[model samples]
Target: MDDRTAEYLVYLDATLTEIAGLARRGRDAYDRDIAVSRACQYNLIRLTADLERLGSDWLAHHPDIPWRLIKGMRNRIAHDYLTIDDDIIWAVVEHHATQLHHALENEIATAKTTLHTDEQTP
Candidate 1:
């Protein structure tokens, strides 16, 4: 893998960890507190951008993920910031973020293994 890809994997992992912590307060807390909700949404926007920067090759390798939707979400959150639906954002936080986190963790592990193997080659 390229150095940029490795760097992004590290960033993605860290961002997801932060998001998970942010959402640990659960839906009620998230919904009740505008700060928590906005924090989660902001990180998601960053996450989506990071995924896009990971390049087409990285994305194509992980076809199982909803790349377009992820990108679209960033746009929605940014463009429709005023009228953004709390329920949908909460759902994305509770559901999709966890899924994406796990998927990224797996991809990072696989990439690390491959990198190690390459280094070991003659």
Candidate 2:
């Protein structure tokens, strides 16, 4: 991966951490009717943009991840925010988190290692 992809990968991983914390913020989101979940959902959308912006090289290697659904989710949030389903967000938080977490963490660490290698080479 190139430098920008590495930065985006770090962003993605940090966003996942934020999502995981937001998931645990449950009821708080429901009680005050907090927009935290919605905000976290937006972060997911942003992460997808980061993915898209990373371009073909990143996508080619991580083709197994849901790039399309992610983009769609972002569109839904941006254009159809009113009908946003809490359950779907919850499900993504519960199930998708682990899968995303693993991938993001690995990609970020690999990127960092490569960056370090490049620095040492010079």
Candidate 3:
């Protein structure tokens, strides 16, 4: 990964961490607290924007990540806020965010190792 891609991945990972913290607050609080929901949405938007910065080629290399769905969710959140469903956002936070965070962590570590190896190769 290039520096920009690596930077985006790091940012995404941190955003995921924020989402994970929000998720730890549990479902009832998420459902009752508008703040929590909005926070989750904001972080998700951040994730999508950063992911887009990674570029399509970088994204294509990781087919396992649901790039289209993620972008789609961002579009929905950005363009149609009223129609945004709490259940789906909650599901993403509770079920998917951690897994994605782990994936991003691994990717960031790999990128660092690759950069280190490249520096030593010359």
**10 residues in a row with least lDDT, candidate 3:** 1-10
Per-residue lDDT tens digits of candidate 1, residues 48-108?
A: 9778888898889899889888888889898978888888887788888888888778778
For model 3, residues 4-107, the per-residue Cα lDDT tens digits are 66667767777888999999999999889989989999988998987888889888888988988998899999999999998999888888888887776778
Q: Pick by lDDT: which candidate is best?
A: 3
Residue range with the least summed lDDT across 10 consecutive positions in model 1: 110-119
CA RMSD of all predictions: 3.1, 2.4, 2.9
All candidates: TM-score: 0.84, 0.80, 0.86
Estimate the overall C-alpha local distance difference test score of candidate 2: 0.75
Q: For residues 1-122, what per-residue lDDT tens digits would candidate 2 score against the true structure? A: 78767777777777778778777777457436557766777777876777787787768878788888888878888899898887776777756865788866767898778777778995
Ranking by TM-score: 3, 1, 2
Q: Which stretches of candidate 1 lie over 4 Å from their true place?
A: 110-122
Scored against the true structure, residue 80 in model 2 reaches a CA lDDT of 93
Estimate candidate 1's alpha-carbon lDDT, on a 0 to 1 scale.
0.83
The C-alpha lDDT values of all candidates are: 0.83, 0.75, 0.85
